[model samples]
Target chain A: MRSQSEPTQSAGKRAAPPYEQIKLFLKERLENGHWTPGALMPSEADLVAKFAVSRMTVNRALRELQLEGLVDRVQGVGTFAAQLHRVSSSLTIRDIHEEVLERGHVHHATVHLAKAESASATAAQRLGVGLNASVFHTVIVHYENGVALQCEDRYVNPECAPDYLSVDFTKITPTHYLLDVAPLWEARFAVEAGLPTAREAKLLGLKITDPVLIVSRRTVNRGVPITQARLVHPAGRYQIDGVFKP
Target chain B: MRSQSEPTQSAGKRAAPPYEQIKLFLKERLENGHWTPGALMPSEADLVAKFAVSRMTVNRALRELQLEGLVDRVQGVGTFAAQLHRVSSSLTIRDIHEEVLERGHVHHATVHLAKAESASATAAQRLGVGLNASVFHTVIVHYENGVALQCEDRYVNPECAPDYLSVDFTKITPTHYLLDVAPLWEARFAVEAGLPTAREAKLLGLKITDPVLIVSRRTVNRGVPITQARLVHPAGRYQIDGVFKP
Candidate 1:
């Protein structure tokens, strides 16, 4: 493929903004992994001279990149590359249905199964309950346009909500139900890349080695963990979000 | 290399536990980007036959994989691969010192510049304050082991905290000083990936096109935002953490 930014001056005249061109060039470099994480670039003056743009234009491109968390700038010093580390933010925890609808996409769910069950050792530890404690397990297959999208397998502590199993998961989501029952005093979550097994691959209509997005959440109310649930979404479907207090 | 698993067959002849072997294999694949996010694998029965293991063993591997947020399984259907989306979880949020210490590394910071100033239009809008509001701006360069790491540019709302310029940011972090003065009610934050410009790259000792982790936060007290800060960290050095209810 032709270079998106080859510095074709075209007689040193162009219609687009110089800063935009520089921005596009740098963006293309980043996307193509040319610069990579933790790599440094040329100085402002250097960029100006090379790109045949003013210092202000180069500053704008760099300023925006810094605001977007792409670069780090220091006064009396040169610029450097930024290390793109794992991000944990607050924008991802909204209800999936609400999120999808907010994006102007249709969303729906199919309750595959729901029931009361005994907690396993892992669940006991994570939920802070005794082994075999009465827990509510629910399995739901969410869909977008009748296509399987997510498989939500949740385990709720009955001590937090005794009537968990009695509620109809088909009408309301586990998130909404849990929030209604316990009011979400606090929560802890994690996201990571994962691979699905044959069963899961078939359900999502993906091939082996396709990436998946997994989110694990644990909720506490008054210092007591009310429930710990894991929500699974197929690749290219969902993301995570959160915020930090200064 | 030899398999990293415990033998579990008949007293003397059992092969490695399927879960351990599977986990190891998948770990290798992920590190190699073979079974990247959203990749699927064969079914339990197929894996069992392929590895010559019992269905129970394969079940154990698949079960743990789900807990780790690797796959999505649906009843009466198949499983699907999960995507390793951008850093989206709230689990990586933490104090810089804590994070560095947790990694068995050293942490340090150098205040490149710290001064009080007025909030710009974007800052005022984000903080939900009056136009041209008086604000405290502090720019810092955080480092890890003499390696320039993060460049933090912060703007504090003077309306929320009147004595914004009295403290010494050289000795303490803005986070520490802010918490001491304002009892936080809530915080909204965001994180993203991108590249940096010439000046920023110099301070962070990064190269061009290096991926950067940018964290922006706004804290509110009684429905009024007191501070809006942007923290930039080397993508390799920083991660955010959180827990979401439901």
Candidate 2:
């Protein structure tokens, strides 16, 4: 059940503090049915008495457990184990190059095009720039273990990353370079499943009937629109995984 | 920017509280570049003095703003605006029928198959049941305004919902019925993009060249494995939308 997500990894590496031990101890009891879902948990005072810990320690333990969806708390009532009817999940999207290298695979990039262009109406709106504004555009194909994995088509606001076109894209990913130049403060994303365009299919060496996953994003930093990017991936090699417990 | 994501709707619907007013006032200033990201925000005491509000109110405003990705709080230093470098996004997977209706379209369901079957090895593992145990299986095609949108293939553990196969699927969604029987306590979800199988294409009335977004989820309730469902949507008819501010 413990895959790549965040809660337990750091908690496991540290020596057990009193609060951490309390949380784990209670979580174990709750999981083993010491209290059924929605059953009232012991009051803070009762827990303080039983564990011989400070009220703040018990409170912190309960607070964290609630945050992790292990328990639920109601105002003017006692804490209780969670009893959710709706599925809740969090997804963490990681960098492709980092993910590939962690899996012991080599990552390579092929630069297709990099140059300045006048923004189209759609591109201008997405980047919050005026129409016909000078913006940098780049098309790059990323490979994992020499297999075509992702093709990125991007439009960057000259104000956000002035050197977007000058950098050799074959040497550095546009995502890494852009992030280095302007930290992401806001974004909007949409994902569509579709067959790739003819140009995309040719670049990725894909069959005509192959499916592709497309993700488009618009990013903003410090009130400045940064970039608009569309990423395409072959379906056979990519999936987004998410896990939830509540 | 305000499409479907949280943080501002309720704050707008209700009359602005003192904290809400303060939050908006500061957010407007920040978004207009009165202060760059990472610049020190006014200290709590300073805010209270300037706004003539209580310290608690000012603190609440700052806290909520931080939670909304509009600000970042640093202990022992002043609060700062968000400075995220990575794109953060959230995808909300809602029921197809509800989404269709929300679009002012009609929804129809055609049940293809519904019966009890001996669990195969993979099905047994997915449902956490014994191999060869009885499990309920169903296949349904969903339509929005006469256009096929989703094909749902589901396997339900008999123990989790004893009346699963007896229900009238045409009248009720499997998801609604399952939640009524056993509230979802845990789930794992995987999303894949691919050309649908011949059978799936037929169910969705999609062409062989059409792509599909396939979302598979394993659900559990009260520590018992409940159901595993795979939902396939025609790429052209449906898309998953997500928005993020940081």
Candidate 3:
């Protein structure tokens, strides 16, 4: 591939810049699956020799790829193809199982706790129910391709979903089931960075000190609170992405 | 104050629940400036005696307040009124100074670094400039009422904002200036939770171990890359809040 001293003339057109050529070469390889995720590409010196360009040119190509989220470069370690982490915005409530499967990855859930419990004052107030009212509480750890991705702690008002406890959560996510039972009319959400509690850390398989991206959401159906959930994701593994107009 | 309770009948209505009455009482005190931020509230035992309710009711009331972000409950240290933290969402890009003033808080900026430098490989790629192209970089710490709220590190493409370095940043934030110079056409943003770098921690007056909420944004004008910025906020002090319809 390096033998072509002249940038391949597409119908005898002017050659693209050396850096652009190098970037396209690497991008094509990535797209063709020749270089799998986590596979290291050629070093700067190697790329320069192959492209017959200055080392700065090769560096610029790789840097652009890194900025585009295609590669990860460690100071001491060579550059490796990066696995793109999916970004979710709080603008839309998406079913995690569907999201995972849409990415061509396997999805599974481990139901840690699902039971009817007396609502704490906080839950009761948020749910607009009398204190100590029966509420269905469920905690599930969602895994994508066998790796834990989200820890969902949810409280469902018993009046909205009386059969919440009888559902087989492993087969269908609580989010899906709840949406079916109580169509969402409105929701208020807050996203924050927080250190996970010990139990949450253990369930997410994260370090106690590691920060987690927490999305606290309360959904209402017809002006009545149906469910409130706290979704936790490991900091390094997840991000929220959105686009906005002025 | 609690001697003639009878639920403190307002217009001789039915008495509110013990916890609801306590919640309202505390909320009134907080709103009327009787209890200031960070001021410790009466002990649970005191609340129980004052309301003529069980200890459980007082505990529940405080817990609810804590969950609502209105109070901080330290296990052994007691509950104290919490300073309301600001939350921003990616949906809209509001001027920080405007946001602070709207909240009745003073806003100020401390310009840390403002200079022209050759773009690093990363910046060059993100800004779509040639290798070693001149780029204007600025670092500013934004404060609200003398408390550091955000540390903004921004890189501007010289082609987009030629007068970037000449502007007095302390008087006008880079964000404000940039918005004026380049009317935002479109923007892409990603928010993540991570540990701050040493310089970011120092500038934000946060402990190195503390996590931060980071929002990385890249704005374009007529499909041309203009500026890329990383806005960092101390996790304990900031959150991102948003509402969306299905």
Candidate 4:
């Protein structure tokens, strides 16, 4: 670990504020695993002397890092590196295929159903269409490293993407295809936990009574509804994580 | 229902944009229960004629409403009122007692444990304290309408709030008190579904095999660790909802 006695290598070359430079120094130690999670960090006084900066500067750097969820400081005890958690921003729309690939895991899908159908009352309500409107429906199961991860049932508004029936879903997910053709203008979603239906259980190879994490989403483009989807995953296998700035 | 033939009564007096006016018109209808969920909404042509505005104006109104989860739109079919779901932004921290009161339900809490003790390895890691450091621990169950709603287990770093043990929990929740004394600077959380532990199930009055929704949260203030908390709710009773803009 870089200590207070370490030489001040970049004293005059940097134009950034003292606090910012101190933050970078601390960040590098954390990122490089020199400062492990739960390990005590250098005291403000130590940092101030090492960087030849004011105590306020060191305090500001540490405070900013804490606000970013990067470190945790105790009043009288001292600051310590925070344990890293799965952090996801609610504003970002994540692609499951991309997520799996990023983790260096193989991704595959099994298409169960894909066809054009008259919208049911529930589907009609969610898709913002008149009763019996033509809508495309598809059901697919996604796998990561050969383990079932998600069961997706989606309803697409035909007016938004008339070519929905012709596309091969096995190669490209409905989400990817829609984003390519229609693009998302806005979205709303809800997350809940519940027992899976018999059919859903059978498809996911889970017991009927087993719990599942359910995510319901609706997306719109321009001034038109594009799609509504229900995503289900086995309990204990998936989580939705996030960070909040107050 | 207001029809296309209705005169635009406020046209000359209202200074808002045409689309904003149209949006308010639709919103009032939905809020007053004049239009029920799943009911078909007026078409764009109908809205344009009714508001005496261009088609683009009405389209923008409906599109914005759909993005807000107030309505659903279908391409050749027609727009319809959306079913209301629990929607929350991850950025906001919610108070469970206030949440229950907002639903017009009675809220109460049962305190199980409140004391100061040495931090365990896991607690120490989460709170960024050293081994055997003094930490305050509390366990409480929140009830809504006489049914148990949540079991909260929390650990607080004494350095952040020294009076953690002396507070009257029945009169004031730990969370409420903490926020009052030590406002949060940042927070991270995760939502998962899992089976409750034996002790948790007993406290929650649930069967051992029943699923539960678990939320783990860690919050810091000014680069200092304040608290780490775990909240567990019955699977069918609670959810974490969000809206995302892309």
Candidate 5:
């Protein structure tokens, strides 16, 4: 039977720092089955005597435990041992280009359109520019291992980078090229579940009305508007996560 | 008028640490118009003469700049100052209860169903438990500010926590109560976009066939089969993100 107490690491009878001793002591107890999840532990005074440490040292160790979500302290009630909640720090959203390269798969891009176009009201408001302004537009399809994975529909403010069309995007991805040209100032993002139209579904090699993941990001570069891109990915193989420091 | 050759801080600084000086030197030159986006930068040899520093130091600085998305380098071709492409971080999916708390809105959950039944094949496989074993199920509608915002359909394995039904869930959130009792071990997640059924939509206060964001998570507790939860939110107000150190 596993104990609920934190495992304590005993330091050989040499003088160890009070804080470290207490941390190890609690850790071993937790691991050795003394304190179980939701089990209230001894009071601060009790622990101070048990560890031959001052209240402040015990408090410091407990404080760290609380921060790590290993224990919950309630007013008037003693601290209780918490169940181990593994908050993973490994989740990440990688750029498609990087992801493809990392998988040792061949990456190819086809830029169907790259030219200046008049902006609609939605585009203008999104770019924070005037209506009908010349906006640089690009329609790109990215493929991995000969399968199309994403369709990037993008709009850029011409005033932000006037020579947008001059660069060849064949060798580098739009994300790679833009990051090189424009330093990102700020960004806004949204994600939604949507059904792709016949055209979008065809491009993604999926059936019509299949559930799709749509990610939209609006970026501002320098003092002018940079670009807004809509990335469409199939839902079966994608998930995103980030850490929170409370 | 910003001139591509306008210099500011990079001029006449030769005594500082080479990397720091080079970074600032490039920054000022870029800011003052010496190096506009897409403009070819001077070769390492040229920078070596300009700052009287080793090529290695200049190379280190340029490498950092490249990683920061400020410059592009081509084999046998010169380096070019790149446009600022915005770097967007991945999003954190907030629990519905947490989101309501963040908005300072009152949150309430109306439990639609809570019962124990023999685990179905699908449920057993998902929970990694024996088929036909007892399992707990819960269906809940979450309201924020008196508006229905989410529907949570969850299932739990009774072997992981026998006292689950004995607790009153109306006064405490399932998440809070479960966290207090059993700590989460590992989680698998999936996200997709879909239209909800008429009943689900009504429960969430969403229009029929409206785009909805659905997230499913299966959590294990200390190697014991625990629970799986599916959460649906109105797409208009919900977003998901995952960030990584790339």
Candidate 6:
């Protein structure tokens, strides 16, 4: 996408302040992973020349990003994009499909298991249901570029999503369906490193020795437990990385 | 949430196995934060006497707890409760000591390595310093109740925190020390899963087979890189978990 920064400097009637426009332009590239973490950003002189703005305006934009933890600047040294990979400073629980697609990549799911099962001890406690109660189960392997990215083992509260079993998970992810059926009010997440179980290793095409990042999340809606999901990703390929402003 | 009061009402002969009874008794104390993380647990002999069971039964009970990462059993030292801290939200970068103390537990640190080192390729790039530049390096093992929870391998920009190597890490955390010298501007964080290196495994007293949760953090101040830290925790023993509201 073309940066809107160049024309804004010449357009006197533009509503956005010069520094705000510069911030927007820089933020877009950073968010798109274009600059990447530790990559040097444009020098203030370069930005001033390109945007046709004073050094002060360019400095303000860089200063704001530095304050927001998106960029790091050093005296007599160039500014660099702060570490951005594997970061998840965004406070939203987004679907894997959306995350992949947002990066201009294809995201597909291979549903291996989708059925209702009697809640095991873990499922019962995580979902806050009676022991042996009916819990909707789905095991899906999400793929990016036909390579497995995540093994999503999710247990849903039947009361929250009665149609969970019937939905074609290959098209609609469990996260997407659950969001439509039960608006997530809050989330509790515990992240750890673990060896994938035998079944997970097989489905994800991973060796048992390969460590995977596991995000165990229990989501609630209106004070009621809705779903608990175990999302596992390859250690070398995926991580929760990002920076955020308070 | 099963009420176990009925079994206690009899108080004559417990239905549970001797080991199970012991487990429940210990679990109650741990959950109530009475024992606190890192606090030494009762010895096997003491447990056996209290539960009126054989040492074998108490051994079995403690072994189970150890596997679950609830307690640490040093070969020569006594068993201590594992860290159940860091339950911090996404917004804050908290000190490990503060996290432990918040749970009413004791916190301590062992400074394994603290000195100036030439920046390696990874360190130079991460800290945005020239290759072979002098960088402050430190490796510290943080404990909660005497149970090692985190192995922190940290690199600091000498320009930002000149007195990094001089401060006694056993008394003050790097996080605490850096904040005073270099006011934190912003932070970048990435959480992953991986196996620890030989040195890390040794420091944390973990086997090579054990998985570890790794949090790589880059903090900047006034647009300058302050410190980049690699924090490793035993997968089964420690995790980053919490609930947050929008």
lDDT of 1 at B144: 68
Q: Candidate 2 residues B1-246, lDDT tens each?
A: 532311343544675767777888887777666766577888999887777777877887887777556688888988996644432655667777777888899988999999999999988987788899999999999888999889998999888789888899888889878766666657888787988779898888877678988888888755788899889989878887766752
- Write the residue-wise lDDT of candidate 6 on A1-246 in tens digits: 435546353446656887888898898777555775677999999999888888978987887777566789999999998753213233333578887898799999999998899999988987778899999988999998788999999899988888889999888888777756665545688888988999999999999989999988887755777888899998887877657432
Higher-lDDT candidate of 3 and 5: 3
User: What digit string (tens of lDDT, one per residue) describes model 3 on residues A71-143?
Assistant: 7898777988654321111134356787788789999999999999899998787666779989988899999
Q: Pick the candidate with the highest TM-score.
A: 2
Q: How many backbone clashes does every candidate have?
A: 77, 0, 0, 3, 35, 8
Give the range of the ten consecutive residues with the poorest summed lDDT in model 3 chain B. Answer: B84-93
List the candidate 6 regions with Cα displacement exceeding 4 Å: A1-13, A16-93, B1-93
Model 2 residue pairs with clashes: none
Q: Which ranges in model 1 have alpha carbons more than 4 Å from their true place?
A: A1-98, A102-104, A107-240, A243-246, B1-92, B197-199, B241-246
- TM-score for candidate 4, residues paired by index: 0.63
lDDT of 4 by residue, A71-136 (tens): 899999999987543221232335668767977999899999999999999889977778999999
What TM value does the first chain of each candidate achieve? 0.58, 0.86, 0.60, 0.65, 0.61, 0.65
- Residue-level lDDT tens digits of model 5 in A1-246: 313332244567665666766776776666544777778888898887776666877887886667566678897999987765334222345577787898898888778789888898977876777889889888777888878877777888776667778777667776776666665645666777776667678778887656667887776644567888888876564445433221
TM-score of each: 0.39, 0.78, 0.61, 0.63, 0.62, 0.65
Q: What TM-score is obtained for chain B in each of the predicted models?
A: 0.57, 0.84, 0.60, 0.64, 0.60, 0.62
Candidate 1 DockQ category?
A: incorrect
lDDT (tens digit, per residue) of candidate 1 on A1-246: 324333444555575667777877776665544664556777898887787767867987886666555667788886765543322123555566666677787778877667887789987877777898887777777776666767777778777788887787667777777765554445677544455556666666766455555556777655677777666666555444455321
The local distance difference test score of model 4 is 0.77
State iRMS for model 3. Answer: 12.9
Q: Candidate 2 DockQ score?
A: 0.42
